[model samples]
Target: MAIIKLSAIERRRLSAFITCLVVAILAWVFTALSNPYKFTVKQIISFKNAPQKRAFHPLQSDTVNTIVQGSGWQMLFSRMNDDKKVIEVDLHTLENRNYVVLSSQLKQINFKKQINNEIIAVNPDTLFFDFSSRRVKKVPVKLITLLKYQKQFAQSAPVSIKPAFVTISGPAEILSKIDSWETDSVVLNGLNESYNARVKLRPSTEGNLEVLPKSVMVNIPVDEFTEKTLEIPVKLINNHNYYDVKIFPQKVKVTFTTSLTKYPDTNEDVFEAVADLDKWKLGGYSVLPVKLTHIPSYSKIVKVEPRNIDFIVKK
Candidate 1:
């Protein structure tokens, strides 16, 4: 083996030659990418301008291969990009015909994009459909929520949604299976006050179904909760044999949490504590259990002073 060492001047010359070679390669690459080229990419197909008189379902796939004529740079960048392109087909022709030609409507579709990247062709040049009777129906809009509230705070009133009902139109058979449409999930954390906003509804999975007024307004009422204690008289029930029953404690302390807005107006009249005599007769229990038969909505029962009562029965 022979080791060849070069002088300082020779080393500098070699470095310059390598630098020039790299620059020349980069320039050629850039020029090639700048030239026009044609390529094909997969795109999702959507529809617009649906025929009002006809209900149709597509017989083909929702995706198609789109051939585009553009700069080589576009092809190189498009391959690296993760975003998908969508092509929309007009269905107005379906009123008189059963199929649509994608090539014929490229001009109309491209007009909406207002771009110079021309679409050369589509793999599935034609789209077919299955027809059915169209039906219109009105269904309730259900609000979906995933909410978290601050400590001692809760919903004080029923949640409200404007235009509770939405109109849906689609194939008669499909519409018959749907009773209600649900909105996108409403998510909130540490909710402590009233919330009001507009939410979009979940889109239909069926391509032939259409939902009107795609969004709805929502209102949720929230309030702070406070504790309340009331002395409610215990009533005896299920004493079918006319037994004279005397419970040691005639009244029990009911401690509960209610919204601040209803605190002032809330009273023991809204609560009913009863001792079921059937508990002893049916289960042969030694002690009678006291239960709250009636409690206001949106109120939480914290503690009942005497959950079990001692009674004397005489026949």
Candidate 2:
């Protein structure tokens, strides 16, 4: 090619193009350096198989730091591709150093892939945890029974529970604080006879707790009872006008049912039956006075059989 010199205008144009290209390259490098790529670390902690009596708080001392570095574009693309990238961790990796603290820290720290898409690896490999002391406690239990019976039937006494206590075990902080426990109340309204039932234990207070022997067997002592009969005095209201007529069977018989322990002795005349004749008229009429013959201090009547009676009078 023959030697051709560039005109002034052509030289100026070439210079401007070179400067633009250099500026573009410099901008790209600066941008890349400003923002770097990042990755996520995921890990799972393990513990020995043991009965979980109560909920536990994990230890935090042995967490392994996980660090990931990449180009900004690479990190962004990784996060977008797969948010849930699984990271495998070996339990054996956690050797020594407060296991409780490590375990606690592992639990507290939640790791997941960045929303953008990224590759992540959990550092230190294993999670740490602590095995602490636990104990079982014997707690006093109270039983209650709820019963429903026919209208004529009534519950005679308070329901009784057998072996009124149970054993409970859990974390020391939880077990030590609990003083006592109770069961649901037993219903005894309109109960004619005795009954047997099973009740469950309920915690009297709230906290981290575990109850052993969740249920208890309750023995309710109930029996059909009979009441003694007593004869009561009769008062005839119309008897004054019918002086010529005589009344027969002037006394009334009253009977009720009660417990054997509450039965009155033969020598004790604690009950009486009476008849009321306050509104009796004279002409071949019979009148009787009403009276309450039987009364006990400590016992309750199950049923008052034939509570009332009549008397006959003549004019």
TM-score of each: 0.93, 0.33
TM-score between candidate 2 and the true structure = 0.33
Least lDDT summed over 10 consecutive residues: which range in candidate 1? 108-117
Clashes, model 1: 0
The superposed Cα distance between candidate 2 and the true structure at residue 205, in angstroms, equals 9.5
True-structure RMSD, every candidate: 2.0, 18.7
Candidate 1: misplaced stretches above 4 Å?
A: 1-5, 113-116
Tell me the whole-model lDDT of each prediction, alpha carbons only. Answer: 0.91, 0.53
Writing each residue's lDDT as its tens digit, candidate 2 over 137-180 gives 88787765566765534445665665577777656776777776
lDDT of 1 at 176: 92
How close to the true structure is residue 295 of candidate 1, measured as C-alpha lDDT? Answer: 97
| Candidate 2, lDDT over the whole model | 0.53
Tens digits of per-residue lDDT for model 1 on 218-299? 9999999999999999999999999999997899999999999999999989999898999989999888989998999989
